[model samples]
Target: AGSPTEATALVCLDLPSSQVEVVARSSSVAVEPEYLSIPEPIVFPTGGGKEVAYAFFYPPKNRDFVAPAGEKPPLLVKSHGGPTGATAAVLNLGIQYWTSRGIAVLDVNYRGSSGYGRAYREALKGRWGLVDVEDCIAGAQFLAAQGKVDGERLLIRGGSAGGYTTLAALTFHTVFKAGASYYGVSDLEALAQETHKFESHYLDSLIGPYPERRDLYRERSPIHHLEGLNCPVIFFQGLEDAIVPPNQAERMVAALQAKGIPVAYVPFAGEQHGFRQAANLKRALEAELYFYAQILGFPLAELIEPVPIANWPPPR
Candidate 1:
């Protein structure tokens, strides 16, 4: 796989003929390719002395532009959905989207994520919120200890199951200064009752059988623990989503607003479990970038109207 500094080039190797065929060159918005940062694979120790894996992408590289002297770039830790899904090392424009704009990204493969053996994947079973949350926190600490990212500017984001982990991290821990959740689960009990058949019993393995472990669900659910969350948060939800449902995001937004916390909720009509419309996708991405810039005190690379945030405090 190509590193973050280099655009991914595709080539076909012919062993019998001892020949190499070039397929295509990777493209980026940056005029110069060298300005893009490459991804570096790293493993760090988490709870139980166990190590978790992640791909760290550094800030954008530009010959003419230099960051403020003695300034460290902020880090955005991404959690993949599925809770069972694993982040691949493949070249992704999404990762580049942030790095090219000066944000560092850490794509985590927390315990219970796939790609590793069954044992590692099963580690998340019956410990979804705790295991995933710890691994993400560990990854941030690992990067901060290396002095590669700003320790105080940590952020977390994810979709679906990963979104759940994002909310869990923001609510249960204070590691992240801000967070974004794309159709994430706020109430585990609601998810257990409302999710479709395919995943209706999925939590049975992740958090234990529902009704049987009702208390556990309530304890881990972020909606039930809004008092513990303090940082600013932005949520993107599909109004037609059946898996997580719109009410989940709505409830969380309402609670945060009631508490006078800085919160922004973006809901799209006619969208399903995930956004499919091009316009919606673009809007969501832009809104997230704008939201982060506003919260973190950074200038956005692109011109976008600001998304309204409720209960935001004036600059101190």
Candidate 2:
């Protein structure tokens, strides 16, 4: 129930003796305790002052390194997979991967995310692309405005439903400088019509009854609004993904390539909707970091195989 940096304890209250007994007070993790980044809960305004969203900000931390004087760290804004799922202050090594490497992380719990109450969850109904994207953008902007992160280096990433939000934000807004999508939905219409029955029914509330409100789907779809997305992006997809097939990432990558935008696509064989194998997970994370380093013109501390980017080093 506690984060990696914090410990959870179980205690007993003895009525007869009027004394407290401590049963448990510690937890363990693979990494050393001092190396883990701590999460700070943050609430910020979004929707042009119409609404508020929550997030957990983890600043860059390393036991042996210090950042350059007066240099702000780059930020990676994470949108959790389930549009319905909420992010907690849990010890996530995936998040620590960035923080441990001199990058700040903002794990956003946007408007539609659960655990905030009925009205908050209902906020996404009929407004999936709008409210969620707005909240994410706002969270990044809030941190930038507070002199916490480099606004020019704001990046976003997500998987599945969260990946949809990443694409929407990049396509419809100009806040982020780069992004990475893992099996994201580029076209909402395609997803509504092609996905399984459960997801199809779910979209009824998320984007409106499919056939009847088809116009909304097209308007919100990132594939249809590619012109707005001018920055670099990298995509990771499982070749055998069924929920969000590989075609989703392929189509977007192709479009970006044609537009001369910086893009990279890394597809894994035998992987599915979410990466389960240990090796694939590690490779995906390393590839994403490599992509960011190349785009941002920084040298990575570790040697990682470079991801080939289409339309890189645009003509000066």
- TM-scores vs. true structure, each candidate: 0.89, 0.92
Q: List the residue pairs that clash in candidate 2.
A: none
Cα RMSDs, all models: 2.9, 3.1
Best by lDDT: 2
Q: Tens digits of per-residue lDDT for model 1 on 163-250?
A: 9999999999999999999999989999999889877799999998989999999999999998998888999999989889998999
Q: After the best TM-score superposition of candidate 2, give how far the Cα of residue 132 lies from its true spot, in angstroms.
A: 0.4
Give residue 147's lDDT in candidate 2 (0 to 100).
100
Best by TM-score: 2
lDDT of 2 by residue, 89-111 (tens): 97788899999999999999999
TM-score of model 2 vs. true structure? 0.92
